[model samples]
Target chain A: MPEGSMGISNIATCTAPVNIAVIKYWGKRNEELILPINSSLSVTLHQDQLKTTTTIATSRSFQEDRIWLNGKEEDINHPRLQSCLREIRRLARKRRSDGDPGLDSTGLSHKVHICSVNNFPTAAGLASSAAGFACLVHTLARVFGIEAELSAIARQGSGSACRSMYGGFVQWIMGHQDDGKDSLAQQVEPETHWPELRILVLVASAERKPIGSTSGMHTSVETSCLLKHRAEAVVPVRMDGMIEAVQRKDFPAFAELTMKDSNQFHATCLDTYPPIFYLNNVSHQIINLVHQYNNYYGETRVAYTFDAGPNAVIFTLQEHVSEFIQVVRHFFPPETNDGHDFMFPCVVLKAGPGPCVVDDPTQHLLGTDGWPKKTE
Target chain B: MPEGSMGISNIATCTAPVNIAVIKYWGKRNEELILPINSSLSVTLHQDQLKTTTTIATSRSFQEDRIWLNGKEEDINHPRLQSCLREIRRLARKRRSDGDPGLDSTGLSHKVHICSVNNFPTAAGLASSAAGFACLVHTLARVFGIEAELSAIARQGSGSACRSMYGGFVQWIMGHQDDGKDSLAQQVEPETHWPELRILVLVASAERKPIGSTSGMHTSVETSCLLKHRAEAVVPVRMDGMIEAVQRKDFPAFAELTMKDSNQFHATCLDTYPPIFYLNNVSHQIINLVHQYNNYYGETRVAYTFDAGPNAVIFTLQEHVSEFIQVVRHFFPPETNDGHDFMFPCVVLKAGPGPCVVDDPTQHLLGTDGWPKKTE
Candidate 1:
């Protein structure tokens, strides 16, 4: 530690909402740059129900940078972690050199210790990486007093994390630049754009780590010709259609496109050599139930989309939420023997804002000593 | 009833082997003609293990065309059935017009009674339609005494049935003709070509009827853009690769391609709107086992392919059959409580010949009266 900056510490806490891709991001053109093969769209869920709370503490007394994810210290040397840290520091240096008065010079050179936790169970098949990275970058920015476009930095952490930087509708444009400078997430609409639109996360009973999106998508790019065609021909059109539907608040159109795109993403997964099976029996039954339920109403009342795992993220109007939940419970009866009220727990949320700074001191996950506070 | 030929009944019986596609047939361009969107290749299982036997009886005394499948009467008015019968009769008339004196004129005008039965359990998930249609067409040709390119007739019965027209390895050529006159199945290699290749039908425990190929493929064609790209860009190269592998008797190359194509077919199934779920937990576990087993051996010792259901049709060289079967039995233990030796009954078979006429009188499924004999 530098003697002049001894015992100096700065802390920032923030929470980022989880974003469910409506037009899925599957293949990548540039692995290192995290440049996607096709543009993707997502709806950011309300943070109160589903989010990652990340607290970053920077101290001149700290010997090195570190991170604790959900109470366990993970490898701080992970390549993606380094990428995110490097990009953020680089942006902070540029702002300081450009005579930005608000830039914290001491915190810029200080080592950071990040503590992150999710509100929902990590085993529920919900993707935490997006929210985790988004919250990390957002909190790090606040501590360093650097606030420009941070989504590009989050993109360096995880491809889908870029979309989580914005609330409501967001699109990750697949830029043509070799350097990936133009490839960044842009907001299509704000949180209040569609008030009646609701999102439900159906936590599937089976909890297994799916084939990591990085490796799974890498194989798809290499082996699946169908994926190549899909990236080139199919997704571009769907991205446009989805944006239009969200803009018009056309529930039926948005719901249909969301389901189709999710199905196609999983299709590409299966098309990969040796194939990948993510959705299980419960997932399939849920798909059938949703379609049957929609058919009974003679219109598309509900739509289901699955990510890399079996848990389904459903999109429907506010009016249909109760009925859809009832249908899900009836079909997948809760196991009373296990003392659970639901076979798959349902988390209901609506579109909400992106990462925001936490002002309350009690919510701080890190102590003044630049380490995660012990939980009782 | 026609009094002129009331007492005359010409009966012919034939058996056809069940063919499992390595390169799957999933869509059609011409539904009426049964012209496939993509060419497909299949290995015919040995008749001794899995096959369909059909008896065709032509009698002027019969009031109308009738059919029985597995002892139960089925509507003969089915369009595909009508297409097969009409094509055979049309071909018979053409042969007679060409001054072929041996054509059976009385049998051509007679109303036909068709009876078909599968040797393997229908609940085993083995495709019976391909074999059933092939046997029906082959037996019909014998009774009518017309035998020039009968595969085109079989193709009308089922898109995959055309591949069952020839032995060993067969390819259904997806012709460019709108009329489908040139669409025909060609033999890639006879049953004698690959002597050491073996097949095992893993009869998965779950035995629900799958989405019929006709309806399934129809939806895929309509809804899945990935299916479109696959037919256009993927299968052509795979077909060539598969044919070369079969010719070289290359087990590794053949196995890899077989697994890839099957995965792609199911991938297209998932891409279908209201997405179809063919592979269940058992199917997924079997897939993982096959991959793990091959990985353990450090070579492609076995390969698996699934059609429209959970049952896995595995392919391997003769040297690996016993060990692989042991692996399968160990992983999927037989149901001792149900008195079944194998939970998934394994029927070992080798590549076999096409449909053949049953010359023995006692083998006829229909009695001398031109009616299906009652099952005792």
Candidate 2:
């Protein structure tokens, strides 16, 4: 996607955790700069269960910059990909010009080879782009020795990608500027702040969404009056309450706000002129089950938030996780009791670290020859 | 329920057509008085295909006030029912006190018996309450020999019932009055104004809705900010556009406004706390089919609106009805081709008269004995 490091002898591999927005980021104000209409908060899930590993290798012998996604080589010139590459290299040059001593010695502008793959299914409507871009930017920074304020660059790749640059509870502030320079993600709390907080990603359907968020949001901004009102009046207050709930570890408050924000997001979708329906029958069934389960407990024990798809990302406390999983199983029975289709078919995760370099050479996605390696 | 016409010897029978709101009524400013928070407009469907017939009889030997709905006796003292009964009697008494010569001949005060039934299924969620209450109030008015303004009395029965009291396109103005005397339904245009407009009631599900409109609107008024905004800002402008569209006989303009208003109503439902979902998978599929069919024609040939349940009410020009019905059948095949459950299980309706006296003695719901008779 971009010219590789000046002269790096070693490949850089980094893993980025997927972040699920509780306060969803839907419409964008500035399409080109990827600025959101409202501030959103999200939790970065543990990389151990779900993550994207991206390895970038630079070589003087390489003919051109190339990229491989999920073991398949794809166009390196996709507009958003190009934006990420341009921003990262511009920052590297700035660092070198400022005599930061981060540039390598060879002074050779080499072609780049990037290989990225996710441990989970990309078709599950998860925020894979967020993790992909976050990992790419994080790896590029490591290669170029450029460290400060990288989230702004990641925002160019994908709007929500900026949030995955930080772990645990992060807020992407909707700044009031034409250039969107101030709309960057800030960490509200680290992964360890709420150990009791747990996440379950229930995959309702593995099919890709019919309409992408980019196009769906474009129509919403143009047609949906509710979305405009929400951006102007509703979200400002919700963002503050969400941050406070995270800071205080108030489970009930956080759960209620999260669920309400999610419903409001989908409501705006329905309010669109022709209307957009992202949640299907299974999604509705899961929503009903969650509400019934909470009502049975006489409290808000668990909350579910969906992001532009049928899959549900659940938020619950550690104490309720086991029982809740059992309850979910009781309602939505798996097709098979065998190990393959069993276990409720969801990943139990927690808040975890953001993108970081992998120190082990054996885990590198590229060979020492600066080429893509074939995995078993 | 009201002591029937100062004891008229003859039973009065009246039929009222169902009204489907293009501009929905979802909240209340005064619950007891049934004053809506926003003005709404609806089309009264033709009575031949779908209507409610009510008969009222007064006799000196009759017992306390009683009522029968769909061949089953129901509580006569239901608060809303009582409100209608009390309001009508108060108006009749005032008329008598003013020396009105048009009052009935019989001066003997007697108890009343009322019987009501629908030509269509009551559980279809087809605004049966609107038709039922309109028929009730209209029958009572004929029995009492009072006819100055009866829509306000019908409003006390059910909010939408006010619209059904007038023929063709009616607009119920959300008047600002503590007593709700000014909140009344007025005819925007008679049924003969437009002969090309057609409607189809697509029966998605006949099952009773889990939450009734009365209670659902209560929750929405209390919890949904979008509902308040729609009432205060959105619906007023929408009401004007809808009335103009109906007057101009602009099918596209009318269809678009109808679809948009219905979407906004359902959007507010989803924005409620814990949220309310009225459209099921079939409803969504029908919506998609309409959009796709319209897109295929490169024009708005058809439009759909859903109320508090899954059934879809379609609006199209007379020229497009047959083609659109064919498209709907192609998408959603009927389970049977027999006379029963066949024909797509829908009634093709057109704008028609409001409530009127059914003069034929043999057509009366109540027998000559002044009690409910067994029907074949």
Candidate 3:
């Protein structure tokens, strides 16, 4: 575990929103530093479908700084956990004059305790880690009263995680060279910039993975040169187009690029040594059906993109929601077949304010200390 | 509704394949004749997923030759049905003194009873009409002993109906409209040319549509100018690329073009006025999941396409089917939920022959004559 030699007391918590990559981040330049090979841009999912709530508590009663996640006490000694904790401490600004001696004037020399609970399932490929790491870093900064830009701290955890620090449009700069220092995320635009732009996340199947992003990216980078091209060529172009699309409110351009980039990214994965199969028959059917409908009608009405799992996030204007729902309803009628379930309720979220702390922690997180033990 | 005189006394039954329009035939130059503005392409699905089985009977005991579909006597006077029958009879050959018509003679006149049953649901965007028309033509051809190319006769029913004439990769020729006699389908390559290719059909939902294809296409063409650009600019290039991909056995290229073509076609649909929505969250999620898995692994693993409705037809290399199946299994796990059916076992067909008449018709299609009444 990342340990604490000096004495400290009292704990504080923090929260962060989930993000969906628009200009996807494909390869890595520095795996250890979590530095990206190219810049990536993502839209922060309004803390509903994707969020991470983390709590940090420091007490004299604690013997060491232990970390727990989603009810299970995780070994903080794991290199990833250790690296995240250590990096946060290094950047955290000191609050008082030698108040505890636990954290030095440099802020790097300190001990902290972290307990996090993700609102959604991890390893389901819904950007849970992006939210988790962003939350952890955000909470740590709050605990130490440090303000060194949360993205800077988030960069140390995962490249994409840095983008989750801000709501709406966020871009992660893929920096140059081997030391992996200059890379960090910056806000391009906020969700409020275009409130009419709505997204519907369709959870296709909530299946867990044998390999998580940590190793998946590594395999992808080593075996797949297409991954290299996507990181080097496609993402850069997509990034520029995305920024412009967001700025101009060009739905067609936005829809076209998002769909193309996503298809290309997956194509590169297929170009990898041993192919990966992420999409099922249902996924292809949806894409085909959407394309057919769009062609049949003749324009860009609803645009869709997918992350690691089989779930889909659809981007549509407010006006077209009902028509979209009705067409889908006809094809996927609520017919009960031998023990299988299929339903899609067009979930609409009235764009809310950016991320804010809840009135109370217990009710918000559904348990005590934001780390309730799983009853099941 | 193409009727014969009261003296008909014999019956003939036949089956034909349905062809889905990849480029899609949404606009018609002549609505009365059901002539399309642009050519389309489709693979005739092996009969298991979709096909039309029809029986034609002529009886001296009967009055005017009548028609029955799914065991219910449908309106024989429906204009479209009458048009189809009249056109076929116009070219039908006459019987000799022996009461047998030779294949050499063109079938210019025949008044025969007609009955058809779609193996799958009609008006579900599975192109039941395409198969239905093709079967009607083929059965009449057999009954009249006409030897004209199947495509030539099918065209009289519906423009896209011609493409269902041959198995494997088929292309519809967009002949000059000075005379509408030449537009017909031709086999690009036989099914034997690409034996390694496999198509997986996901019956997402079996619900029928409110808008029939004829009306739907008419509305789309009249209102949506984007459909014009799609037929002219997008489809030509896609057709070229698709043909080349198929010739080279380049799975990735073929898959990419097929998917791209599908998307472009759908984009045009959305561009239509009063935008059409053919895909839902479930469909979108499936698309995302497929792309994610393909991207994660980094290879050209699978290619997917969808028709007018929500059903997805996935084309993949025979080798990677297991991996594809595994990924699909993980996402759409067979589990009970809210009494709504969601998942089913993915069916894989061993390489086999195309449609052949069932030894015992009662066991599969419900009736050897026309069809059984709708159970529900």
Candidate 4:
């Protein structure tokens, strides 16, 4: 009856795509459950361009759970992390108790070792939390042999993470129930919905330490009357329009709504008490350049959305990508081809699939020994 | 009578202090009439530190209406300029028609010549329009022998100019009148009411060409839902609290409201279509600095407000002025005392009287011949 008599060990590696929200998710009604105040829709960028690969291994012989984020050890007792693990374990136990034919009943009680790493450089300042958490939840679910809808479990890690659990266009429904069961992400459209849609991530030149999203949203919910109004009166209508625009493949309609929603999100940030400024001078200039560029063409060829940071996530059709990239360079010229300011890391991305199991053993971030593999 | 044959001319030079809004006035119900969407309150800074000295002359033999601003000739037919002039003339004609014995009916047909100049350097980038328009209306009224309230007339030139027409704490009431007669500035407290209150104008060294207030407000009104909510739901209660704060001389209450209203105004700007950015990076830093300083003291010792530009106008009590100045210098060190970024032009000011007619001939910006006096 020894724990390791059968040497029970299972490892799953999953890669998740980053989602850029057109209808932004800002505040949360239930902080612990990570339920949003309003439903939000986002475009899942292709994983070939930007993604987070998470490798999770569970072993009965392991003493305790441990987690490494980008090769750095983090507190395993973090509330959100604990919540995600607890929910997945509960799901696995339920599946086994229901007499499911395929279930790793022994691994359900096993300690897990998790390691997540992003494909893109951290200097880009693109928020990886969405993809990281989504990957974590997906990989954890796989290792635990639980196949049920896991967006709700990912929701416990981060509100936006729920949306990242789906591919292409996704919306996180702000569920009404107190238990947050119905508050799961739904796929508005599949990966093949819009092949021409492209996203440009304009990395900020200056490194600005902006306020973290969790505290920012907390303050916005508490002090900002505008945030309350937006959540109650504005977002519901915006969500419908966004869904329609995505379904119709209307770039201009989609672009305009995306930019407005992003601006409104920052507006609420500024409206918070003592006010939070996520957009720096560079972000402001980029915004003007986008409008000016659009005005010049008499069309919104490109749209930008910021996520609690200065880095701009631009949405444009594949046809306009080259021209808009030229314009961005012209306005914000990189000092040189290799300058930091113009890192010009334009990962031209299109709508892509969500978390997928990676069969390649070499792609795992965690070693067979259940620890982060050191990279030289 | 031959032109200049009888030099029957009356010249009055009046200086109007600059007023910084604690409760901002953004967006107008009527563009032509300068009717505001919401009420706003301001603190009129001392004329000695910052003012617009405007000299107006009404002469029977002058050639035509002319204006020279800051020694540079400007078009006399600007619509807002014409509005102020026409209103002043109508008031004078009514006074003369009523058969007032002291009324100079002779000057009724006279052409006016105006020469306006700001005491603060143009490099300061403070909006001279408010003080300039207030002074123009007041001085024109004095020269034309009409003593009725002039904030309504000043408002035509610039929306914020109306608040500058009064000393101490002034509020521009957003009256529900088609004619905008009731939307005039009212004095909540005299200059002597809050003597301990002080203002520090932290003029920006670098000039930023922001969207002009008229166009910015126009866009906010047309596009931003947040602006509408702010005008209707937020400002009325804020206006009352601001007035009470002023009347009771509650520095902390007044300071908190000032910062919040300023932030809300900027929030509306960001919520505008394409969004407008008034507070630059420097302004944002100043805001953080103020909040941090206040936090350090365990009391709200100082508060900062930014209008439609980068310059920060900080409100604090006289007792904390020296310490705050030191803190500002420590945080934003001036580069060798003459660097452009650290102009550090902190003009300490207090509430002062409204425009007053300067009887001294030496102070006149206009010559006896109704022409601009050269400033050699």
Candidate 5:
């Protein structure tokens, strides 16, 4: 047990990687339960390049549970946040009740203070929520001394967050049960399975905030008949195909399916009653450039996928990375005629391991006062 | 009979209105026959505001068949052009063989000189093909002295052009016949059915030529699985609902379905492999403004649709036309801060009649030389 000035507290620090979906999860069957309409697959990106660092501290004398995201305090009463917190506590209590000897019985009733920050700028529009929730669940599990499966708890925060539970290739099985107990993230393969695979994120300069995936998908489910058909017919085959592509280390097959799935997802967005526009001119240009580059080589050497924003995540092999990057730079020159930097910012990353626990004392986000430490 | 410099010729001048698809015709099941994968519905705009005036002459002494579009001579050897010309001749031959006494047998094997022009600027990005092909087929029928269902012939020129063969609310039935002989356009209601309905073409200033519908739909059919689902499952039901909406003159229901179908069409475009982008920032802004205006009024007053371009074709009742147009002008200010005329040009029109011949001799495109006269 750790002692704060006011009372006894347990603290844990952990970090999670951002996962980019190839076969995307669009609509939720159960909004409250966060159960998706179809199975989804993703590639967990390297934590060193992009990650969320979360510090969780549970104290006996704390006033209440609170959370500060990226140096700014947020509403702790947000329903999704409550869902994650409640699920994690329930799991901890279940472990104790099941006669798990390793359970820390003291922290079960304690209030928690969470400090979460991303290494990358949140404004960059790289999916921070997946990493945020995954880190929250991982750190909370460590603080409570509960080590059982926690992907379901992470999913209660965000539908896509469940895929971030494991590194390398992961799949979220859309189970049929109403209770959603079987709908959990499973690792298809380890990080070392595909050493040559590379991911490059082209961060577009977004002018306005796009519609949230939650509300956008809600509209799709309610109004888009195309979406319903895709969920029922198209995705099951795609889920199987993507899993096979990952297992076989088939780069071209994987790339083609990624791009197609991304296109179909945006298609569903357009099919929504009011329609949604996610990709902008830059994103369009990037897509064209990728295809043109691949066509020039007489084969598909690169693939691009977009989420709910203009940014594009490209999948390619290590051998083609340098040439592809050069091609991108050539078309969208970094320096404009007036010497201003006008190019889209890009981050190159590779497949990496899952969430990690930080054992170093100096890296702790919470101080002895059971509160976040002041930083310069 | 009219006498050219070399020989006698039969000449006919006609004009056809541009029909905007509320329910779009996208993919084709039989490319050669121009048979669509799904049924489509459209509203024909008044020819007085926007139309293609085409003059065709069949002369015995003409050297070869030729066509001039908007003052520029184009190759008559284009396959679609050949398809139209062959189909018209075949129909005329069939009529003659059947001993139709009204047929002009003398002009059966004569060569044709075609000159077509639009009342509005061709660069405005409004769909010219629908009206252009419809007028061509209609005029050719008159010049050849054959009076039969010519929508089938026009369909061989372009799929959507078949729908333009009729006025007011028309539907191109995606018939199941393998030979495409039964695939034809039918009028759901005459132009006078909906007196208060109006169409406004918000011609967006296109910076570059968009992908032609021919190649665009080709790519969509080959790549987009969502399109497959839409054509198979979604569109059939939409066609029924839209026809009912139009028959009942239910403005709100009609508006909702029109907007949704248009969105789904563009969504299919996005679902294309390389992903075609027809809507731009200006198009997006207009969509937002329309929705925001409708939400403010607590009713659907206006609905919008787009073809293979950024221009928005709005469907609204005559009572709300002025207000909607005012709302449009307010959101997209005509004058920019720099005093440049950046306003999106608009053309207001209503449902009108089908192609009609001009009996006035001065309206003929070709002069005595059996060729198009030079225009200043």
Candidate 6:
């Protein structure tokens, strides 16, 4: 039999959503495995704003494994991607030995071809890796017929990336003792817990990122004492504050900590050796306007926060979302020459249930009739 | 007397720097007197960024007290301004009775005419009121030859106004007892103490304020449990952190606290019943970029903050200033186009010392002949 002809008979595929860290994941204690020093949290925005959709297929007919991103085939040799694939295969091997009925019935074989696409910018502080890893893990799990928890396998891909595996409010518990044995993501409060909350994302400007989180976190760990204090002293208080605020549906408390935590996180970033520039002039103006407008209205109405880009993620009650939209429109009036470009591109999404299988996993790897069939 | 022929017989002038609060002051217990609920601290930037230069003169020829701000004469009947003037006068009366030789011997008459100009935006978040009222009180003291502490009197004009009276690090004591008599601005440290520090300000965007600070504070007082918690819980920790950061020359700590305080202050603004929007996208971007860049570099190199306007003010050690400037310039590249002319309007300035006596008060106001004369 020809080498390329073996591709179609063996493999399977799947897709998953990308996640962005609200409480960022900065440092990695173990680089090869991509493990983090502490737990992080993030909001998985709706797929419309940003997401990753990937499909993985395996066949006994295939000669070598292959991959494509955004329709263009990328080098699978990239170390980060390689590590992820290798880890998932190792996990699948363990599941295969369990002798489970589910694993035995898939009639699967092992030459894989994976293709992924990101709806947003790649490696530009948008946490593209989070979605990439989640999808990779999910695809491999489905292919091998491994029924174990998806998050456990995802954690092997990237520490922060694991949290992205689940939806709604998820927490990455950095288990005590450095072997990283028990570290995994757990869903804390579901999306439906707070239905009235709305997020206003202001994409101030999307310019090329000056630096990547990998190198940045390396420098921060080596140089910043402030980082130590923040990770140890401040984060604990903030986490407590966050949990209480979320539980009570206390907008005032939540807004206060959200803004404070965002700034403190960035402050730690600045405390890093050479410094960082996240928020720009337009970003600053939005923060100020929200502050003064809120003060004018005299109540806890809106909370605005910023992540790694010149984008603002503001949370306000559903009742005042229209007001937020109106005020933002008025302040950042439409530009002439330029079509309807918003200084703050507001994304209003109600959180969804945790990640679930989007496609049926019971179908055969090849056509049921056993003819040379379609390719994904 | 012919109105055209009327001229001032005596004039006294003074200048005050605009103070930007490091730990902001908001929510006054006594609105009439502008007594703040908590002690505040600020850095008096160079007069080049923001300051109020005022000229005060009096003559029997003038029928009533009158005032002009930024070239336009304002209605003296406006209660805020009126109260400011009357309060200063009452304090001046006490100074005159104390047998102050400067007041008793100066050749000056009644019916004062004052003119003031704010180098920065009048009502924007740059704290123009702080400089405006501080300049007013300082000039009033000079004219009345009042020996009383300028800060104590400045407080009556605007609570945070007191901090503007001095140069460098200043603290506005919230005072323990209910009478609020002891609540006043006091010098924490002086500017010369940390001359190596550099401030890079990014003017995000400007807006005509929807509500002034006075009204904003009033509304915050009426609502916002977050405001109460901040006054009791957050501010104290920040105040301590700031003072220590400044005293120890700990840039990492200082940067963190400064950034944290700014975000927290704005958060409180959001927590206000109706909510206020003080910052814009530019402001938020500045913050995000700072985080990304700093996280990339790893160590304390720069710190960013925002006032009530959509502007970003960043502080860093003198050494990194050039790099920051270059980065900022690169990000906001200059471009020009027009049908008939080229315009590059936004100019960046490195601030200098705050408002001070340029023409000697005795030489110009008292005149060489020992008689005050109107220059105009």
**Reference-based TM-score of each model:** 0.95, 0.95, 0.51, 0.95, 0.95, 0.63
Off by over 4 Å in 4: A1-6, A101-104, A121-124, A205-208, A336-342, A361-376, B1-4, B122-125, B206-208, B336-340, B374-376
Residue B15 deviation, candidate 2, in Å?
Answer: 0.1
- The Cα local distance difference test for each model comes to 0.86, 0.86, 0.64, 0.86, 0.87, 0.66
Give the per-residue lDDT of model 1 (tens digit) for B37-113: 89999998788877899998888888999999999999999988999999888888888889886655767778999
lDDT per residue for candidate 1 within A211-288, as digits (tens), equals 877899999999998899989999999989999999999998999999999899988888897788788777887889
Q: Can you give the DockQ of every candidate in the order shown?
A: 0.60, 0.51, 0.04, 0.53, 0.62, 0.09
TM-score of chain B of each: 0.94, 0.94, 0.84, 0.95, 0.95, 0.86
lDDT of 3 by residue, A70-178 (tens): 8777887877667777766655533444365554343233355676788777766578777888887777766665657767567777667888888788888887856
The A-chain TM-scores of all the candidates are: 0.95, 0.94, 0.86, 0.94, 0.96, 0.86
- The docking category that best describes candidate 2 is medium
Docking class of 4: medium
Q: Write the per-residue lDDT of candidate 6 for residues A146-177, one digit (tens) a residue.
A: 66676756776656668777777677766665
The TM-score between candidate 5 and the true structure equals: 0.95
Show model 3 residue runs off by greater than 4 Å.
A1-5, A8-66, A70-72, A77-128, A139-160, A167-184, A188-376, B1-127, B139-148, B152-160, B167-184, B187-376
**CAPRI rating of model 1:** medium
DockQ, ranked from best to worst: 5, 1, 4, 2, 6, 3
DockQ-better candidate, 2 vs 4: 4
- lDDT per residue for candidate 2 within B1-376, as digits (tens), equals 3354343375799999999999999999889999999999999999988999999987766768899999999999899999988888887788888888877645236677999999888857789999999999999888877877999999999999999999999999999989999999999999999999998998877788878899999999998888888899889889999999999998999999999999999999989887889897677878888888899989998999989988889999899888888888887777743222233637788999999898887887777667887882
Indicate the residue-level lDDT of A184 in model 4. 93
